[model samples]
Target: MSEPTPTTCMRCAVGCGHLQSGREDGHGVAEAKGNPEHPTNEGADCQRGIEETVDPGGDRLTQPLVRRGGELQPTNWDTAVGVVANRFIEALSNGGGDIAVLGSGQQTTEAVYALGKLARGGFGTRYYDANTRLCMASAVKAYDSAFGSDAPPPTYDDIPKADTHLVWGANPKTAHPVLYRWIAESAAAKDSQLVVVDPVETQTAADADIHIQPAPGTDLA
Candidate 1:
């Protein structure tokens, strides 16, 4: 095996640093571990990060494909690029009524910025949105309303210092295992109270000092 390459895990927005072990032949990642020097995770990793590094190219599209006779067929990159460019040009010439870009929050910050620039600056389209809007709109709105901004006030470092942790509708054990470990460790060390409010009894809730199972959509009430 070759030397481990230090990289960040982009599996989620948390941005956990990882040291990936790969071959010099550049075939694929063999194994990975958390980077101890990372500020965000600090030698902690989630299952998703581990899975991603192990099978980085599983079920991935290596070549571009185009729909032909109602079936997607592999095609050359030039042809694929031409097809998409032609469609975008046609849409622009026809007043861009059907031109829109739908992005994902899973995309890297650079990727998201490039897409935004392409949509707004290159295509001049206002019909650009991301899946983050659907997933985090309510939470962002509440934060903005309360704090006049959508930024999260607390960092992961604050977990250990907090006397009480009130987790709502988030399963850190599955969704964010690294942070969950910190929270669990803090609770154990400080004997801090942990209040979990979720419709389902999740793993995090199981370890909580108080688990409040509110009815679906009735948490605010």
Candidate 2:
């Protein structure tokens, strides 16, 4: 069999490289082994990659669908596009704050930028927010306090080599399963200490060397 094209996993932000073998819609399979040449994954694919072979394109929502009589019915692409565009234009002119655009930081960099421009520039709305705010805000704030900027300095590879790890207010196991694998590997093989602080008792917290659960809404205290 011929080799498949190398592409990154769109499933999550890990962006692990995968070899996809097949057409866009037809029967196909993807084999995901980490791209060692990749600066991040280092030839190690996590659970999502291993499971990509099953239901490679099974659950994807392709084509446009609209709810008619509370039932989603497939519609032509042009018709769906027109309807959505018209509704967006109407919302802009209707003078209502009820319309909000939600974006994801896990999206590709270009995809995020395009969505931002669509909301802030094209639609004249300033309520663009990424899901990362709820997950990594404290870590970002901590970095900004010390480095004078909010930026992720080290990649996943660096996590395994770091001496100290501070996981605050985020759960990696359920939310970021792949990254959690790296964390566990780091803690076991590298002797890196894990410190988790969260209000909820998450899988990551259960595994941490030091787990601190403060009172709800008392993160500042």
Candidate 3:
């Protein structure tokens, strides 16, 4: 196996950190090990998350392609960017309201922030949305109910220091193995309470100090 090279996993929007290297047995395989020091995951590795890191990026585009002569052709970055800008300028000239952005869920926090800025600040468009609005609706609602804002105040660093960890409607054990590891380790070290509230008893509920399973669609309805 080649020496493990530290790399960031872009499998999901979480952007977990991991060490990737070649297979030791010369089997042409790759193994990914989560980095314990990463603030995001804290050394958690879900089976699916690790599996994505091993993919060779099949059919993924490496460069910009522009349609030319009735076919898409690889072009330089500057040319490709200019083409897009010109199209956007043309659209804006007609009406900025015509432009809209529906951001993907497979984006980092920084990417989403930038997209928001471009959509609102740059384009001055009100027609903007993100997949997070659909996928993270529960988290958003919880945050709003708790803090009157759709953003969490506590960082991951607060996990280890807290006397109690309450995971609501989240199954970190399967969905976020690294975060589950962090909570489990912290609770074990400090004898802290680990409460999990979900509609179903999941792997996370199995690990929690307390599991509260409300009827499906009945929590805070």
Candidate 4:
């Protein structure tokens, strides 16, 4: 293959850049590589990015499906579209135009934007939010309150330089092995302490300088 388009993974806050290669159908194979230009990654990829790849699945549909006679099958896209369209139309016609849409982190920015527009413009709904509201809402609130926004204070390089490294809540050995390597290597560099805190003991916990296993529901304590 020749060269591939460079882009970042939107899956997480790490936002590691990736190299995508394949045909023009948009379902391209991807891999995580170093992004020399990216200030944070600077040519490194965590496990999440390394294992990421193109979806072998074909183009997806937003249309609804109906089940008839114990079998689920595709109905007329137009009728399905019209059902939603008429529902929204009736909702607006009835002056009950409060609509809301749940967006997603996995979707590209354009898809999210279109969904937002559909809610606000098409349905006149102002209550649109992504499912991340449940996943990262608290973290966002705390980070914004402390750091003034979603800005990440530490880059991937900064992990190696921290004298005190704490691995809490998340087990990076299985979740993000490449990033966990940085922590392990940094701890081995002398004078740096690496601590693992979780409810369950994992491979990473076994290798930590200190492992604290809190009893089940007492993780927050």
Candidate 5:
């Protein structure tokens, strides 16, 4: 193994520090371990991180492909980029009103910032949005209506101080294992009441003191 390099895992919004060791030839990652000094996870890593390092599945696309005559063919980087650029130019020349850019929440902050700059400054279009908007738009609207601002008041550190915790429409056990572990530990230590509101009985709901399964669309009601 090569020398371990400290880096941050980008699988989710919650950044976790890790040490990645590459192969001796430095081609790919060989092993990964959580950084003990990191406040977020403190030497605890989820299955996602381990899978990313050791068991990267074989279904990845290494090169760009373009469709020609109803058949996809491998193409070089320049050709692929030219195709995308031409399409963007054509779309902008026709009309910028209907053209919109959608970004993923899983992307790095730098990637998202660059995309925003490209959409707003380069293309001069206000039709750009991220996947986060799909999930948080309702909550943000409610917060804005109630408090005149969209900023949330609570942080992850506030979880331990609460006497009761309620989770809704999220399965943190699979989505955020490290955070779920922390919540479980806190609940066990404090004997706090845990309530889960979900349409289905998830692993998190199984651990909760009370699981309320309301109708799917009636959550807001």
Candidate 6:
């Protein structure tokens, strides 16, 4: 085995830090462990984040492939980027009516900032948007209205310090395992309250001090 490569888990937005100890059996990953020093997860990880069964090249793109001639062919990053730039220029020349810049949740804060700048400053397009808006529009609007930002009210460090955790419509056990670890610990150690609001009895709800199971679509009532 070689030195474990420290990396972040991109399985979810929690972005837990972990170490990837290279595979030994060629069939499965030999070891995947969390970083003890990481402030976000604190040596904790979930099943999906730690235990992954990836068959080599199993529907995963290893390199950039651009359609040349009639099919996608492997190309260098410079060529691929150049091709995309040319396409963007051509589209802009055509009045940019067909141009739209979309960002994803996976992108870092710096990346999204650059993307927004590129869309508004470089491309001069008003059609740019983040994909999260389509799914979490109401939540984003509420956050912006209340806090003047779409980011979460509390940071990852603040979760454990909170006296009462009100988890609404989100199952941290699956979608955010790292967060669940802190919530569960805080509830156990500090005797903090964990209130889960969901229509289903999710794993997160099971660990809650109060599980509010309202009728689906009737939560406000």
Per-model TM values vs. the true structure: 0.81, 0.60, 0.63, 0.68, 0.74, 0.70
* Candidate 4 lowest-lDDT run of ten: 23-32
- Per-residue C-alpha lDDT of model 1 across residues 114-183, encoded as one tens digit per residue: 9989888888888899866866798799889988888787888898998888888899877888878778
lDDT of each: 0.85, 0.74, 0.81, 0.71, 0.83, 0.79
- In candidate 3, what residue range of length 10 has the lowest lDDT sum? 22-31
**Residue 74, candidate 1: how far off, in angstroms?**
1.5
Point to the candidate with the largest lDDT: 1
RMSD to the true structure for each prediction, in A, is 3.0, 5.4, 5.6, 4.5, 3.7, 4.5
- What is the alpha-carbon lDDT of model 6 when measured against the actual structure? 0.79
Task: For model 1, give the 10-residue run with minimal summed lDDT.
Answer: 22-31
Clash tally, candidates in order: 0, 0, 2, 2, 0, 0
**Tens digits of per-residue lDDT for model 3, 56-114:** 55687868999999999999999999999998898788667889899988777789999
Which predicted model would earn the best TM-score?
Answer: 1
* Candidate with more favorable, higher TM-score: 1 or 2: 1
Name the better of 1 and 4 by lDDT. Answer: 1
Query: What local lDDT does model 2 show for residue 215?
Result: 90
Ranking by TM-score: 1, 5, 6, 4, 3, 2
lDDT winner between 4 and 6, please give it. 6
lDDT of 3: 0.81
lDDT sort, best first = 1, 5, 3, 6, 2, 4
C-alpha-based local distance difference test score of model 2: 0.74
Instruction: Report the lDDT tens digits of candidate 2 across residue range 75-109.
Output: 99999999888888788886534357888756777
